[model samples]
Target: MTAEIKKQKHVGRWVAVGIVGVIVLALLAAIGWYFVRVNPSVQQVETIETAFPEESLRPEAGEGDGQPVNVLLLGTDARGEGDSLLTDLGDRADTILVAHIPPDRESVQIMSIMRDSWVEIPGHGMAKVNSALAYGGVPLMVQVVEGIIDQRIDHVSIIDFAGFEGLTESMGGVTVNNDIAFSYHGYDYPQGEITIQGEEALIYVRARSPFSDGDYQRVHNQRAFLRGLMTQLMTRENLTNPNRMADILATISPHVATSDTFDLGTVASLGSQLAGIGNSNIQTFTMPTLGTGMEGSQSVVHVNWDGVEEIRAAFDEESMTTFEPPAER
Candidate 1:
């Protein structure tokens, strides 16, 4: 081959390879954006104003604000119409948890409140705490929780059951230590470590009939399952793999709705702050309550007034690491 002809062929081959590389990079960028971009279903509320608003009691605002960040996590069974947003009306909150991330951001503490706990919902007479969601939506739920803990909630996330299943499956199922074996919906979950996904995971979190304590034991299981799930998700392999992370995010976003005050940037910032925390650093506790009793005709959990104060003090002082339950006290 002539030198000039060979040189021209070589130039053509290099141009073709460059075009292919650009195409591949563009495709990857598009996939990343699809997964990383915030979903519209995560509706932000302008302000999460509670019924009893005391400016003095609210946590300070600014970078390094020297106060623990509180997020109210609501797990609802409200299956809205297909593609419809979760509404406040006629829907009940099945799970209520307050996730506290201290200013140091070294750990996260989760306190689960029994849905059937009898409490005074602001503007409404004494009723089941979960009823607040049906009565006043996110605002009422926040108001009631704030009243109980005496802490300002910085953000709110409402997750449906579908999202829970999707998130668990996206992580290839989560393995939680099953302290007690139980059967639910014809599926037998033996004691010891168990890995569950999809419908089985839903059954695992929702089971309550087998235990004498009913919902109380179920809450404990939920916390164990959550800890296991977080441990799996925080692994370097999962976080660094864009495709895995995107699949997880896409599965979760549509099924979640956040307060208007919380945005994509806020979510990313919080994730960054909490990146160092591990499952061991995440402490989970059930809100202190006297055993279940009948209120009129319906069964409910009575709040232990003294124990409640101790729990509130721990949150107020940002000392949950050392905080003990009423039983321990």
Candidate 2:
């Protein structure tokens, strides 16, 4: 009887130990997953360096005075193998934007440079702003934008449109108001308020053929999409969801190229203010330019230097100028 009792106690001890072991293993797995997903920047290594010849644009870093910060946003169309991010696909910058954060950091100014705008390319002569990236990569692209605006860009971020749909789906969907009814790319998007998924939102912004205004209308749509996306990202549910956060990071991780010194947490915190800026408070406009020009047989968009000064003054916070209402298609 004594031996049986001892054996029973030993069995119980082993069972308890097994249960504890399982619980510990589960907890460890969860922690590993959290780190892997949330701290993507930890694994962010600039492993791939393209052989594309580096052109000198002399991209300057932040002024270090804690004044305003300017960041150039580049949307690239590079595609194919070994080029998870944009590469040798003859990719052009489809869209370009400059975000100027004031000294107060309370408000942000977002200015979109028309891709078609012709400008003097540093070391490459005159060409469209988009072509600057294709012709000489990031370095020249930076120089072209800085030359036009007359203010040095502190940093830059390059984004890819390929995984945008996955990002939208992860958010459950995003909604925006359409001021005018228009149809393009086999999608009939009506006027007023409408919800959009990843694919539909892409179509809305990329629809240039159907509108008479062409790229002008497309730029407006891109701004609208960005606003809606920012709002969706800040919502109670999206902000808290670990899965959504992972998906959002995964979507952009491959395409984005930022300065090595950039900090993810700092940007996220600062972005909250920019995101909260109401659509009414924000202004969207394109750099004025002649329709198009030719550079020794290549077509390009001509830049309007006078308009460039107006942009510089606005970014400098020099004077209050009336913001032109966003035009609808």
Candidate 3:
């Protein structure tokens, strides 16, 4: 063969390989964009602006030396079958939790507030804490929580229980330690490590009738399941796999609504901040409350005034590591 013909053959082969590489790169980019589009749109809460004074706002992470970030995580029940995962203001918040990440970001402290805690809801007189959402939506709920804890709430995220089902299913399921054996709604849950998925996970958090303590046990179960879920999410397999993580986020995103200040960037930053924290380092406690009693015709969990000072001190100091719940009644 002539030298020119040999050179042409070599160059043509190189050109063909380059073309295939470009096509493959383009395909990967398109796949990534599709997953990005799957991210749920953020729903803004306009009234949050008027909910509290500017001075009451907690500084965002990376401000100055950085400060503890307090996020209000709310879980609302399904309005009905086939309801959208993103719950509306009309629905009552069944599970209210304050997830506090300290300045060091070495640990996370989660405090679950009883939904039926009798409290003074801003502009709504005294009512169940959860009623704040019904009166003025997320803003009012934030105000009510701020009033009770005396701490500025920096961000908020609300998730429908249906999202829990999707998230659990996507992750293949989660295993939670059940301290007590109980059966509810035809599902038997033994006392030990229990693996649950989809609808079973929803029922796990919603089951309150089987225990004499009622919602108290239910709250514990929710926290346990949440810790388990977080553990699973942060595992090497899940975190390193972008597609898997995206799938899990996509499943829950549609059913999630956040404060106007919260966005994908905020989510990423917070995740990075808490990445060092592990399940053992994360502590969960229920807000101090007196035993259940009647307030009018409704049963309510009375806020324990004596224990509030301890909680307030820890919150004010951002020292939840030293805080302890009051002894159970």
TM-score, each model?
Answer: 0.80, 0.75, 0.79
Query: Model 2: which residue pairs collide?
Result: 118-301
lDDT of 3 by residue, 117-228 (tens): 8988766788888887778766677777776676678888777777778889998899998898998888889999999998888899988999999989888898888888
Worst 10 residues of 3 by lDDT: 40-49
**How much is the lDDT of residue 47 in candidate 2?**
28
List runs of model 3 lying over 4 Å from the truth: 1-63, 78-88, 318-326
Which ranges of candidate 2 are over 4 A from the true structure?
Answer: 1-36, 41-65, 234-244, 272-275, 290-299, 318-329
Candidate 1 whole-model C-alpha lDDT, 0 to 1: 0.76
Please state the error at residue 114 of candidate 3 in Å. Answer: 1.2
Point out the worst 10-residue segment of candidate 2 by lDDT. 45-54
For 1-329, candidate 2 gives per-residue lDDT tens digits of: 69999999999999999999999999899757766776774354232343222334443444555566777876666655766454552436677987766666545566778787766776777666777767777666767777776667666776666656656676667787777688876788899878887778778877788777778778778777766776667554655566766667766566566654345655655665454454555556667665665777866666667666766776666322344523322
Cα RMSD, each candidate: 7.5, 9.2, 6.8
The whole-model C-alpha lDDT of candidate 3 against the native structure comes to: 0.74
Q: What is the Å distance of residue 309 in model 3 from its true position?
A: 2.2
Candidates in order have lDDT scores of 0.76, 0.66, 0.74
| Candidate 1 residue runs with Cα over 4 Å from true position | 1-64, 88-91, 325-329
